[model samples]
Target: MPVGLMLVLAVTLVFLDLPLVVIVLFSFNSSSSLSEFEGFSTRWYRQAAENPDILAALGLSLTVAAAATVIAVVLGCLLSYAFVHGRRRVTRPVEAVAMSTLVTPELATAVGLMTLFTTAQLALSTLTLIIGHATFVLVYVTVLVGNRLRTLDPRLEEAAADLGAGRLRTFATVILPQLRSAIAGAAALSFVLSFGDFVTSVFLSGTEIAPLPVRIYGMLRFGLSPEINAIGTAMIVLTVLLGVTGLWLQRSRRSTTTSNPL
Candidate 1:
């Protein structure tokens, strides 16, 4: 690469990572001061662990994310199958609407969800939060899995049929295996999005339960603290781990396919 391009890349990376680096560093600070780090300590992390509200919120977030991911993956895979196999005249318009969710402002989606729930007399609660998350998350799953499906040779299914395999058996043994990597990636992405979601959670969460991001925002109303930094650092760590795990799964699947070629 050119020296100028390398310099620009370095600067961009630093610009993006500096804030996260500061948060991770300050999470271990002995003092509450954000400006000056007074030495290393795990005090903030311990405080966060001890906080009942934070723990509850964290648990709720995990539950919602897991549920939403499962829903997104199942619905998304089915939608992807439809997009590939169904008539284009029927699927094309639906695909456009589905993809539009990606570009739709999250705030707008949140507001729309809130309004729809109110109009339908559905209470804003954990269920609503999961529904809101899965609605958008399914689009991601569909896109990834649909792309994979499009690349697949349809003759595999036909060959299986010729061998006396039923539709369900063919899908279970052949199609699902091929989609493992995409499904894994989609599930990981869905979980991350749901866990980190603040706007939708803000609008949909009930008085009894709030996700971690919403809980963190509530904490900020009191002012910044090292405990908040600790929580933020923990969330960052989880997101990175999920992303790495997804990539590892995808690569491993590819390697297995290459090695076996069956």
Candidate 2:
């Protein structure tokens, strides 16, 4: 926490982010040369805008991410709730199993999922992509929900019950509201992970259902393109904006809760 060490850490962080900065800068370059630094222009952006394939991939990625996030939110919430409220012996093992997904390598998981789908004669379509994305996203959702539930006061639910509210009503009116931030954060993280996912998507996505990350990977095989840089730069900006908004909302909620303590 010393000032000099903090400065060094800040500089190191900036160095780590330099690649992204380079991508954003190269995105606006007009020159066809991918190797050399070029002056700023929106030519690559224009090309990206006109490329129907890129647009289609982006649309597909969004759709898959949205669908997967929705599934994860519901399933994660249910799993977390059961684990948190159920008998200790049962819930402990169940929670551990649910979180074990995070311990496995993503490549191994994708390969396993692909093998299973192939064995079942399932088509590698958008549906498969959503399923693949959801598989990993579910763990994130569970982690978020479980962490929030751990911090929540069980007395709130007890109080609601003491007032004659049924378990369902107490959960809907009391528990769910307190979990809003975690839910939103988890959903956002899932969406980003799904959207940015390349390896799983590449294996599960069919010829017709290519997502943006897969498309970007394909483009890379042909060598780096300025348009790819442009697309990546835009994605980086959008991601940063979303992250800032989520953090701001989290802080604002905490401040409100503290100021209006009951």
Candidate 3:
């Protein structure tokens, strides 16, 4: 590597990961001081597990992510299929709307959604958070699946129709199978984005419902501690696991597609 490029890479790595390394290290700290790590223990994790507020926040986050991921997957896939199969004039406007959401800032989306709901006299709650996350995450799904659909050969659908297969049957057996990897990737990416989202969650959530990221941000105002470190470490591990699982699913699906005979 070039000397300057190597220096830039090192700086980027440290800037991004050095604090994470510190948090992971201090999560096991026996000392109370954030700067000093006297010894290692899992006491903080246990304490976090026992904290009611943390537990509630974690539960809310999981539920919201689950609901959002499923809804986004369904709606996004439909949007993808429509973009690929529908008339260009009709689909272009829909695509524009979707892309606008994807490209727009998260703070803007959050604020806009919050204001809309308030104007409509709707209270922000768990349901609103789920809808907010679904709205955000589905953009990723639509883009991913729409690209996959564009790459797909239209002849395959025609061939299935030539065999006298109905539209729904051909879609279920032919089209859906081809998009498995894309769908799986969309689901995983959606989950991670929704679960880790703080800006949208904070803006849409009421005092009664707090997702894990919102709770963590609230905790930061008071101070930092091993319990917070433990929570951060846990979230990082979880996000990694979700990404790995998605990759594995996509890989397996690709293998199956390549190995199967027509």
Q: Tell me, by lDDT, which candidate is best.
A: 1
How close to the true structure is residue 89 of candidate 2, measured as C-alpha lDDT?
A: 92
Candidate that scores best on TM-score: 1
lDDT scores of the candidates, listed in order? 0.92, 0.88, 0.92
Task: In model 3, state the lDDT of residue 46.
Answer: 95
Encode model 3's per-residue lDDT on 118-163: one tens digit a residue. Answer: 9999999998999999999988999988887887778889999999
> Is candidate 1 or 3 superior in TM-score?
1
For candidate 3, which ten residues in a row score worst on lDDT? Answer: 253-262
lDDT of 2 by residue, 164-232 (tens): 999789878999988898888888888888888988998899677789988888899989989999999
Q: What is the lDDT of residue 90 in candidate 3?
A: 100
Tell me which of candidates 2 and 3 scores higher on lDDT: 3
lDDT at position 247, candidate 3: 86
In candidate 2, where is summed lDDT lowest over 10 consecutive residues?
A: 253-262
Order of models, best TM-score first: 1, 3, 2
TM-score of candidate 1 relative to the true fold: 0.96
